[model samples]
Each structure stands twice: as structure tokens, then as C-alpha cells.
Target: MRKIKAQLFISLDGVVEAPDQWHFPYFNDEMGAAVDATLGQADTLLLGRRTYDSFAGAWPGREAAGGEDAPFAKVLGDARKIVVSNRRLDFTWRNSEQADGGPAEAAAALRAEPDTGAPVWISGSVSVVRHLLAAGLLDELNLLVHPIAVRKGMRLFEEADASVPLELLSCETFRTGVLNLFYAPAAGPGAGTYEDAKTHLPQH
Candidate 1:
């Protein structure tokens, strides 16, 4: 099965929001290299509506600015994207498709691909991530935890139905107070258990 990996940047308090001020400023050569290395491992990008909108607006401009020769720009331009959104949208980017549904359905479709060589990456979108977590579709998590604390913002982890066990795969700390932690679900039948019922929680 294709692995569904979540690559996120979060605050000390688990807030995954606009990290430009705290984390984006510190994207040096090492960080760029790390990002490139990580992206090299994944061929498909899965995004939520908000993240899809943000990226679709920015990446195309970036690609134009850097021209076709830019490495990151090329990757961003060529990579296939599957966007999950309830609202209607028309994707202009090549190899991009928008699906209306929850994460579980979208993930199941992605996982059902004939070939399992390529990896599917979830960039951002807490709601979709939560759904994937509850559905046990998430395979690996790569979190860049910033040291700064945001007193009030959206948090990455909230109350779920039950606890899910994750095995630490690897960890590293950068000089800019950002720690990279990789984790995978503990191996077992009920390793990533959660409530399977349909319910709603107020947005933050």
C-alpha cells in the first residue's frame, strides 16, 4: 500500500498555522536541502482546500519567477496534486484533481492505486488530517516543531475519541529552534484506533 505521509510545521503548543515569522525565516541552505531531500521521496501531493488554494496561488507564481530551470520550482510544477474540498473548484495546474469528500474516502481512493511505489504527502489542513487520523489512513508523520509558543491559535492535536500509538522513526534539531520529528503508527491491528462515528466539532 502507498504510504500517506503528513509533513507539517507546528508550534510548541501544537499550533500549525502561518509559521512564516517563526519558521520560514530560518529556511537556510541546510533547510532547503532537507526539504528537497524529503520531497524527492514523494511523487504525489495531497492537500486540503485551504492549503490547495494557498499553494495553487503561490507556487505557480514562484514557478514563473524562477523559470523552468529551478529545482524546487520544477518539482512544484510537475508534481501531481489531489485536493480534497467540499466547495467547487477548477484546477488549472497540470496533473491536479479536486475531489469533494472527507479524507478517508480520498485516501482510500489514493491507496487503491495499482502501483504503490510513489508516496502520498499531506501538506496542511488540520481538518483533513484529523479525518485521516481518525480513519487510520495516515502512515507516516514528519513534523517540524518550532520552539516558539503561540498563546492562541489553531492546535495540531485536539481531543480525539481515543489515543493512537506512534513509533518514533527519527528526530533532528536545527539551529533555528525547529525540531524535525518523524513518527509512524505502532504496528498492530488496532494501533491507530479512534471513534468511527460521524460527529462535528466547532472550528477554532
Candidate 2:
């Protein structure tokens, strides 16, 4: 089976949108290596529409530009990309295709196919991640939690989203103070309710 992994760069307060405004300052070699390692495990990328458009505008010709960022740009440019969106998009990138149905349906079909021994990575797609997580199709979620509190952007999980219990797989802290958190879906509703934990509380 092809493993599905979702990765995001999120702030301490849970903001995930527009990372460019505050993200690069904490970037370092360690973060680069962590990202590289994640990409190295996958040949296919699952992207949300906005991210796809941004990448479509950003990565196409960087390889030939021969800069320090060329190698990573090349990797993204050549990887098989699947965009999840109902809206029509102009796919100008190579090896890119729009998903046939909803996120869950698309993921189910992908996983049901012959195991290619390669993982499908969900990159910068918050909506896709949420959908897949809700559908129980995501095998793993990797979050690089930055220490800053970005007071204004869409968070990874919002007030309208349902509760999800996650199992922590591993966690590492980079020198730049970024937290690399890997999590898998837990089976049940979670530890329990406040009422259930009442026994552990001290008497007033």
C-alpha cells in the first residue's frame, strides 16, 4: 500500500496560512534536512489548489537558474503532483494531474492500487490534510511547529473543525527552536472527558 503523509509548517498558536510572512526567519540547515528527508521518501505530491498555483508560479525554471535552491526546486518540479480541487485549474506543470473526485475518493483509489513502495506526500495543503484526516486516509501527519504566535492567519485546526485524537509518533527540536512533530491517528475519541478526569483533580 502507498503510504500517505501530510506535512505542514505551523505556528505556535496554530496558524498555518501565509507562512512566508514569518516562516523564513527560523529556517536553518536542520530544517532543510528535515524537509529534504520528508521529500526523499515520496515521489508523488498531493497539493491543494492554492498551493499548486503558487508552486506552479514559483518552481518551473529554477533548476536551470543554477542557484542554491535549484536542487529542491527541481525535485518539486519533477515529482508527480495531484491537485485536489473542484474548481478548474490550468495545469501547466509536468507530471501534474487533477484528482478525479473528492479527497477521500481520490485517496482511496490511490491506496487501493498496487503498492509502488513510494509514499504520496501532502504538501502545504491544509484543507486536503483536514479532509484526509477526517476520512481516516492519512497515514501520518508531520508538523514543523514554529515557536512564534502568528495572531492573524488560518489555523491548522479551526473552531468549526471536529475533534481529532492523534498518536504521537516522534518529536524533535531543531536548534532554531522549531518543533518537528510526527503524529498518527488514534483509534478512539481520546483520553476522555473532563468528567472522567475529575478523580485526578484536587479538592477545592
Candidate 3:
């Protein structure tokens, strides 16, 4: 079955919103390469309605401009896009369609399909990522953690959500202070460690 790889550009303080405003300032060749490494293998995209609308609106025009971004624009424009939305979605973008159901159902169905070795990518779709992460359906999570702390903004996980333990796959720090962290849900529990003791304390 094809795996799901979710990518997010997040701040040290866990903000995931409006990456366009704060993201580009720190972007460099290193960061660009890291992004490309993920985008390169993917033939399909899993997007939230907002993200789908944004990409459909901008990328086609960018592709036509024949500029530096045109290559990536063309990549996105040509790839299959699966959009998740509750409301009616009359997509104008080519090869776009609504997901089968909610995030988990849609992702589960996608994963059940015959493996062609291509990945389904999640791009700037926090809600969909959260649902999949909570449901234990996400295969890999790639976070480009920036150094800055944007104290206030939308976050991927809220305080109300329970903790999800992850096993780190790889960690690389770029020259620009960005950290490319790759993680997957842990296979199983490990022997209790010192940190586990803290949770045993009686409630106050």
C-alpha cells in the first residue's frame, strides 16, 4: 500500500499558520532542497479545501509565467490533487476531486489501494494532518522546524489533544537554523524511563 507522508513548516512555538508570511525569510537552498526531497517522490497531493483553493488559484498562473517557480508550479499543476472538504467542492483545477469521506476514511481507503510506490503528500493542511495523526493513519511526518517563536498563531495540535509518541527517523539542522525532523509513530512501547516516573505522581 502507498504510504502517507505529511509535511508541515512549523515554528518553534508550534505555529503552523500563514507560513508564507514568516517562512520565506529563512528559506535558502538548503531548505529548498529539503522540501524538494519530499516533493520529488510524490505523484499525488492530499489537500484541505483552503489549501486546494489557494494552490489552484496561484500555481496555474505561476506555471504560465515561465519564471524560477514555474518548474515547481508545473509539478503541482500536473499532479493529482485529492481535496478533503465538508462543503461542496466544485474544483476548477484539473485532476482535482473530493475525498471519499473524512480524513481517516479517505486516507484509509487510499492506503488500501494497490501499491504503486508513489506517496500521497499533505501540504499545509493542518486539520487533515491532525485527524490522520490522531487516528494513527499517518505513515511519516516531516516537520521543518524553524528557529523563531511565533508566540501566537494556529497550531497543529491543541492542548486538549492527547500526546502522541513518535520515533524519530532522522534529524538534520540546516545552516539557516532550520531543523528537518522526520518521525513516525512508535512501533510499540519501551521500558519505562525516568521521564515516565513523573506521570505517576498523585493528583494535587
Estimate, for each residue in 87-203, the C-alpha lDDT of model 1 and write its tens digit. 778988777888647689999988878765768888877788888877889988888887878767778888766776789999988888678899887854442323432244444
- The superposed Cα distance between candidate 2 and the true structure at residue 174, in angstroms, equals 0.5
Quote the lDDT for 35 in model 1.
Answer: 73
Candidate 2, TM-score vs. the true structure? 0.92
Q: On residues 95-173, what C-alpha lDDT tens digit does candidate 3 reach at each position?
A: 8889988999989988988887788899889999999989999999999999999888999888864678889999999
Give the least accurate 10-residue stretch of model 1, judged by summed lDDT: 191-200
Per-residue error (Å), model 1, residue 9: 0.4
The best candidate in terms of TM-score: 2
lDDT of each: 0.78, 0.89, 0.89
TM-score against truth, every candidate:
0.83, 0.92, 0.91
Q: For model 2, name the residue pairs that clash.
A: none
Candidate 2 weakest lDDT stretch, 10 residues: 187-196
| CA lDDT, candidate 2, residue 186 | 93
In candidate 1, which residue pairs clash? none
Enumerate residue pairs that collide in model 3. none
